[model samples]
Target: MMAAQVPGFYMKNESRRVKIPFIDSNSLVIIPVSVNGSEPINFLFDTGVKSNIFFSKTIADELGMQYTRKLNLVGADGQTVLSASVSPNNHFDLGEIEGIYQAALVLDEDFLELEKVIGIPIYGVVGHEFFKSNPVKIDYDNAEVTIYRSSALKWKPFGFRSMPMELIGNKPYVNTTIRQIEGPEIPAKLLIDTGANHGLLLNRETTDEIVLPPLTLETDLGRSLGGDLFGLVGRVRRVEMQGLKFRGVITSYPDQTEFSDVIIETGRQGSIGAELLNRIKIIFDYPRERVLLKKGAKFSEQFDYDMSGLMIRVLSAENKRFYVSQVRENSPASLQGVQLYDEIVAINKVPAYFWELADITNLFRSEEGRVITLEILRGTGTEEEAPEKLRISFVLKKQL
Candidate 1:
């Protein structure tokens, strides 16, 4: 994407810095944005995407937005392509900052189904456009984003480590090293993706050194623009970024069969997502092509994966209702008789309404062999008969 063609935002007034509070949902940042002066709607703050995109066309239709053209959006897997309409000259109000005559892509259908995945209403994604004209600081500890004017900002290194960044296709990329269990450190060029939720993603086909671990688990990685992405989950010995070293990092390797047709950039290994990024404070200086990082509250925390082997989805965020969307075969949840579509009514004797989605996920990824009780509502909701209510307990164990 060309710099001139990229959509950009401008500061509304003489403010040198603008602070925007965000909601951190499962390692993803959700911010409130108003379109064409409409009420604030939740939008994902992503660095991996080139242009702003609306997951559904409903919002655009409601705002009486007109389509200037149609675009074909390809998924990361490279096979799934969806058509989207481009609404040009739209006004975007991000509190203190505003974008006039901005372009946004609106999908005909909500292909990602992000609400069910993230347990919130995610109408769209705001990407490169937000960072093009300013330096953005992401404070994971405080759940806030601060945008600073390039001219008014002062450089204060302090304890922060500065590393060079490559701005390619309107996205940020950084260089890092990965060490396998029995091999030399492999240098990798990874995209700094704030949109992805996983810790580390490595494309095995990128190089001979980037191979899968001995033990791996076949799992549903996440949803893409196309559909659900299936992949293998494993662990690498360590990942080194500059002088910072992270040991036993949880890694993801997407199935090659699905990515066979995908075209990756030269020397681009994979991406580093929010899972690892949440452990540090980051300042993205796009103008200078450098990123400053400092250790955060979770810097020393060990990396972990979901030990319960159950993928839970939010049925209703307001009602605090959740259900098992997928259960891994031969896993703890399956072994304990946790069936698919089983509504989670309570956990550890507490009502589901009392627990947040993040709280439940944190418990699932807690210590191994940790036993937890679940109050499940089973059976179809049809009028044939009342749903069966049962109690099941399961021990969470590491799969990969």
Candidate 2:
């Protein structure tokens, strides 16, 4: 109701509003896409979203879109939370329809490094507003969406496709049946985050339970929005979804963007990432409180990095100093008493700023007790003086 009062954006401004069967808050679907030639992989429909966004690197490279400039982003309270990788504006053609669009590359140790993205998977994000101009449905039953192109027709969920799902606690769980990707027999029950980039995410428990497949290929830095860190990069034989499956190389990590600690204890199942959601035509029946899961026609596995939160930026400036940038609320860094804007100069007598991603990872690689110290720069003017160097110890136990 409140959203209706304000002027809409792009498609919303000229949207055809028609209420279709909607799930809780996901009454509408938004899918902002860049038509890349005639590839079936171009158009996308997405629901769960706070905003519409896209990283400029892969999409720009694919279509030769010029991305210029850099932008900084602040949290809701206006603190510089992170920096954005910017590119020259570009235009998007959605099927026969076309529209000009702008994009921001998320650069922080968490989102990705523009030039170093792995596999160059998903191009950008589409919000529910994208559907405002067109009424679309995800039929979990048929694993496809029936589109109405015209809002004049009463919108209805056409295909109803529901994959067999298990719930962990209060979250939906999906079974992972990939070979050699063995973890505990207790399958993972994920939240079915339609908003997540990677179609699936492995929890620490699953990560610990499964023996890591040997690295067929290793990237210098495993990526995430969390900044360039070490992750085992390679492929797995196959991961299945309700008997439907695809074979592809996948990157495995120990962190989840949201619900980092959400666990599937006794009776809980694993989670579902966008990788699975985007593949099928499905509806999140929030109104009826069900996710009408379905399969998509275009089911080819494209290379995509399962990451979040940081941008990997190479320092070209000499005498460059790295600040804390910003810390995640109650994160390990914050819990250790690290402050924002503090300069991390070195670690336990080891220089940190110029160190490669591998260096930091090496220090934390030990499967036993590991502790490192930091020499930080804090304050300005009178605060310009260095704070007493503090040493913090952290355990690198198998992340569960």
Candidate closest to the true structure, highest TM-score:
1
Could you report the Cα RMSD, in angstroms, for every candidate shown? Answer: 2.6, 15.1
Model 2 local distance difference test score: 0.43
Candidate 1, superposed: residue stretches over 4 Å from native? 1-7, 152-156, 257-263
Question: Measured by C-alpha RMSD in angstroms, how accurate is candidate 2?
Answer: 15.1
Q: Could you tell me every candidate's TM-score relative to the true structure?
A: 0.94, 0.39
The alpha-carbon lDDT assigned to residue 62 of candidate 2 equals 65
Error of 1 at 371 (Å): 2.2
Model 1 lDDT per residue over 1-400, tens place: 2433445777777578888899998778899889988999899999988889888797789987789888887765676788999988788898887777788899988888888788888999988988877889899999999888767445746888888999988899999989987656789999999989999998777677877789889899988677677889999998888788888889998866455434254458888999999999898899888888999999899998899989988899878899999899999989989999999999999999998888888999998989989999999868988899999999999887
Q: lDDT per residue, candidate 2, 204-315, as tens digits? A: 4434555555543233333333343323444455666556665663535443333333243333333455445556665443323334444565466453431211122232
The number of residue pairs in model 2 that clash at the backbone is 65
